[model samples]
Target chain A: MPIVTVASPKGGAGKSTASIILATELAHAGAEVTILDCDPNRSISIWADRGTLPPRINVRSDVGESEIVKTLKQQDADGRVVIVDLEGVASRLVSRAISQADLVLTPMRATTLDATIGVRALALIEEEEEALGRAIRHAVVFTMTRAIKSKQHTAIEKSLRGQGVDIITPPLMERAAFSALFEFGGDLRTMPVQGKMEPAAENASAFAQAVYNRLVGKGL
Target chain B: MSDKPTFSIDLDSLKTRRKDTTPESQGRVDAAGEQHGFVNREPNRKRGRQPSPRVGQVHAKVMPNVADEIADEAKRRGVQQGVIIEEAWVLYKNR
Candidate 1:
């Protein structure tokens, strides 16, 4: 199985949102998926508690760093896709997750601070590659983007590209539906299937699909 | 695979030793022209077999000096040379 780790050092960068969207989308696509929630906030755990996650999307919360590695190894040995929702800070466990991930997705807001914080995460990834003797395919996807006044977004995009970071297409717009997702404890894909309609529901689904395509298409 | 000898052959010392071994060594024109293929000293026999069709036995062009390139970049980046070297090796291995 290929492990996809969603991580970022800056808080409120929508790491959990991206993780949940990708997990729910993949599970809906008939893949055996499991999420290892390493965030102490347990945002994903709360979402799972509210019965938002589908039965196919199995989530294991409060897992330590070593346990996450063992579980990922087991899943890889069994040929299952494992998506890890890492905490929004740099920690040993988060480092281990990035080290083990076949692909690392670092979601960033369009602010300069958020984009700057991604540099630290990228440097950490480089450090992990040095220690582990392997390269993990990573990309930065812009989240909560504003349609107009996108100068900050463009600047961040240019900076990341100059640093040789892959920026995935179809930026996730800042929609009330995304923040509203937490209240219902469900992702975009789950909301539509569960008969709850929102204006940005389809947009969220499309964004999630783009993430899936990039990850799965590269065989990561 | 047979174990390759692990002798540390310093080129600078070898050049100094060559100067002591030969009267005309102080004016050494070129190291490559003199040393390369000098061990198999039959010039006429070697010339005839230079382009021999022995695919596996034929030596390919040597790879560039990757370590030196990495060290230069590491110096410019103000980090350890090993960091650049290791990152390149990891990228190559992963690819």
Candidate 2:
């Protein structure tokens, strides 16, 4: 049971969306999973209530700093893969969450501003690593980008890589079906979106598999 | 020998006063089998090569109790949580 924490300092960084997609994908893949929605927005929790979640996926909301460690430990101890969706900005909850994260995923769109702010999330992970006296593994994934890699996307990625950041491949493309997921309250697998559904499913699957491999391929 | 690593975390380390909340008066194992405030010290047994500094940065899925055990061992050994994890990871790899 691993704990994956999706974090970014900038808002609308796709933390909630990535959280949903990963938890749902893992559940569909036969892994028992739980998403502890630590975001105040309750995006994942609301989505779970609004739509039929994939089997073996559990979404919980209102998880704050005080209980994050406990919840992470408990859910993980139960053999449930735990995914935590964190709010943007630095806080006690955010720090506490990162301290316990097995993998800290910082999501950002492809843009100069996003790249700049994404550094803050990476810094937060480093700060926690120092505090806990441990290395916190993390990576940056391009979120809400065009399917075709733009020049800007490549430049930003190259810069991050040069700075020694592990960039997870398979960017979550900008798809109407992604928004349709939350709008209609269901997962990308079963969510009905004419024309956009198949590509969106493929994109989500790619991103999910990349993440899962990164988790498994670590320390080998 | 089983390839699976079964590391038992002391329920007592979890019992230790949480960094956030007030220390509890009663010492009881809750339904979750979590014992807060109990500190168990096992001799620091060195295993394999010392982990490189980058071991702290590697990310992967691991058993949940592994993190707890490392956290507890960090406290017991007066080392960083990452150090314990790095050592445990090397041991797991070599196991």
Candidate 3:
């Protein structure tokens, strides 16, 4: 019954990718899910519509930062799992979603600039908790990363740990399969399960599955 | 006197003329099989031990009852609903 939210302040951080991919896997696993697209870009909403996603996956594009809490409260009352895809930056709505989230997954690229902005988002979450007196479950993940760790990646991870922030390992690798996702409007699970596939597609699918497991837990 | 006339129904007079018909209030039994007054105030004597750590199971319990609490919290803290719930949960969970 946890509501997971993907939020970040900077663009190109794989927020949309993470949201769509994880949601797709969960829906495939037979869970009633409602994905609220808070981004004005409407990327996830559009993808769902364009691809005619499975019936189990209900997409709500009308959601915004302002109405998310009440909506989630109502949905929680109805016993539906809520997954929010938040827009970038520290907007009023983004903060509200983070405040309401059972787990706030903030995605950042493996770069100094991304990690720097991530600290700001983490700070905002902490400040909101202090001022509002609500406990918000939160974690950070690095996305669109190369296989090999760079000096910047190690430093950023260490810095975040020093700040006492939770960060998930196994950062998502940068690959064309993820980029191709927006075009086909399909995620890894929806792809051919048996046929031979490109290396990038296989890697993307593995990465997506790994993330899905971490979010929902082992059996899922 | 003017052709137009005005009449008023007297609420005060009506109240004095009605018979009382309320059901008698009943005392509620606590978990320890002890009866207590109808009000929500704490019992006169300590009852059973505190609840188990299962209190965490009801975190979302606050979300549904938020409407009732929001008005009270807003008036007490002079802050917005988002801030009050957020801060309250943090304090509630840590304890």
Per-model CA lDDT versus the true structure? 0.64, 0.69, 0.61
Question: Which scores greater on TM-score, model 1 or model 3?
Answer: 1
DockQ per candidate, 2 decimals = 0.01, 0.01, 0.01
Query: Which sections of candidate 3 miss by over 4 Å?
Result: A77-80, A192-220, B1-95
Report the lDDT tens digits of candidate 1 across residue range B1-95: 11121121121211100002121321121121122211112123344556536332423243578656766788899997656656767999999
Candidate topping lDDT? 2
What value does the lDDT take at residue B21 in candidate 1? 14
Q: DockQ score of candidate 2? A: 0.01
Which regions of candidate 1 fall more than 4 Å away from where they truly are? A77-79, A189-199, A218-220, B1-95
Assess candidate 3 and give its lDDT: 0.61
Best model number under TM-score: 2
lDDT of 3 by residue, B1-95 (tens): 11111121121211111111111101111111111111122224557786667433234445547777786888788876667667778999999
Question: Candidate 3 lDDT, tens digit per residue, A82-152?
Answer: 67897775565565566566667888987888888777767666665554455566778888887688899
- Which 10 consecutive positions of candidate 1 chain A have the poorest summed lDDT? A190-199
lDDT tens readout by residue for model 2, A30-79? 56777888888788877887778777777788887667777766665534
Once model 1 is optimally superposed onto the true structure by TM-score, how far is the C-alpha of residue A2 displaced, in angstroms?
A: 1.3
Give the interface RMSD of each candidate: 28.6, 15.7, 28.6
Worst 10 residues of 1 chain B by lDDT: B12-21
- A3 in model 1: Cα distance from truth in Å? 0.7
